[model samples]
Target: MKQRLLLATLICLPLSVLAQDSGTQSVDNEALTVYGRANVSLQSSDEGDGSYSDLESNSSRFGLKGKGQLKDQLEVFYQIEFGIDLADFDEGDDAVSNRNQVVGLRGSFGEVMLGRYDTFLKDSQGSVDAFTDYEADLKSLFRGENRPDNTVTYYSPSFNHFKVGGTFIASGDETGDDGISVGIIYGDKKLKKTPFYAALAIDRDVADYDIEQVTVATKLGATIVGAALQQFERTDGLYNSDGYLLSASHPVKQWVFKAQYQAVKYDSDKDASISVGADYFFNADTRVYAWYTGRECDIQLYQSRGCGASNGVEQDFLAVGIRHDFSW
Candidate 1:
């Protein structure tokens, strides 16, 4: 009787363990994820007036991103991030971090995000950059979307050949302007070519001013290019506008030869300007770049208080720099 009781106990134990695991399977596989990145480099800048040199810390940073499945039809997700700038050299404390937070949800319709995050155009700019980070050849010059504070965003699933996204900025709690931006990116899988992109953005203040930006970008092999034309208007009759950039790259083993040209036309009769540059890449994440930029600005006669059309002058700039990317 004792041996039979022990055998039955062992059999029941296995059945009990199976029942517990079956009930907890869903809990063990709960939806969640984590990811991050980091980077650093050396750079130099020459604006024709002077040359500045320093080792710049790229977006050496990290963060947590994940989602939780509440049911078959509903789920929630979020991301919080920050940068680490090693350029300071002093590692003790004086570090600064900026606009790197994101939160959102996915549903049957689409995904809606709210937090301090990059606007859509931000990623588009990086697509064409030799170095798509702080150490990048033209990062400051590009001024892509990057991250913004108190922003709301939405991303939609692809419809045939297009994937679309939009973002709204302006918590009104800060000095920033209220803006809405939208973009459409088209993929051509059949052609085996890079996708094409187009975007329109508008920003305004209820009683003060307004502005608009329209952009287009595309890439072919080692060449990536983009353009953004923007118009700014204010109640005081102040109008301003400008746009330009052309680029190409050829990769040979570990090195790349790149060329770029840019032009700018100003509303103030600043005469059109043109720029050209070249770079050699050591790798996909790093490169050394140099540029020659020239600009012609109009002069105003002190006596006539009007434009002196012929007084246009030109300034030349020679620039050299290195770029790198980081992810942690």
Candidate 2:
């Protein structure tokens, strides 16, 4: 009698578990999102002779992104983005600028996107650089940082804090060369307390350009630090250049303090820049910033040491602006 009762109890347990699981299943809601950021700033820069000021729109954009559920392990997604210039009202037909526009499939394996978008080399840098759209942006001293049209990209699923991505560009340009870019990144952004990210990337044959870059960033409590190094080679190794950057930021309450230093060298011409800035956030979608940047460059005749010292020119940049972003 005891064995029969025990067997009956086990038979009922499976049904009870199944009922609980069915009750917890979530209802799917198919939704599309509209997102955008409107950023404008009053900026001024001095180049030894005098200071110049201008009202500018810094990467203001609008975009639509959506994903549809297909199966348990796969989905379809697409995004279309356009840049707007708030400072220019009479630009006529060139007013609307094209940004990232892509459609792709995502699955347990990874993702594949095809359209106009940024290269894997540029995406590998992520949010490492504190100053992106400002005067001291990394692109000011680096090469091959771009978003191109007619591109295909792939990203691998992360495993053990490691992931890889690649991009191919089929742009019909004067160089008559196809572009290839690839990168590998480590560490997950969800980590807390001591999260770290590192990446290495290479780009070739994009408008007769070839470049290799390495970037790393880490967060320790409230402090973030990042660094990057790049080598540029072109014309079958006949020309070569290199650049490096170092940056750090600390956040306190609603404010963030940031600083960066960068240097680039090509032949005998060398340029170096340093910038310091602060930002105040009103909320998650709005903020104000002030920054100061200074640069010095020298042109040499024979790639000799200490050349063009007297011919060097110094420049300075200062800006204060507000940025707002919205999404639905």
TM-score top scorer? 2
Task: Give the residue spans of candidate 2 off by over 4 A.
Answer: 1-29, 89-93, 173-175, 189-194, 236-238, 299-311
lDDT by residue (51-140, candidate 2, tens digit) is 889887888999999987655656678999999988766735566899999987676657777789898899889777789888888887
Question: Model 1: per-residue lDDT, tens digit, 77-188?
Answer: 7877767665665757646575468766565545667778776655434334443443223432222334667577766666765666666665465564455545565654
What are the per-model C-alpha RMSD values against the true structure? 14.7, 12.6
Count clashing residue pairs in model 1: 9
TM-score of each: 0.63, 0.84
In candidate 1 the C-alpha lDDT for residue 323 amounts to 57
Model 2, residue pairs in steric clash: none
Candidates in order have lDDT scores of: 0.51, 0.78
Number of backbone clashes in candidate 2 = 0
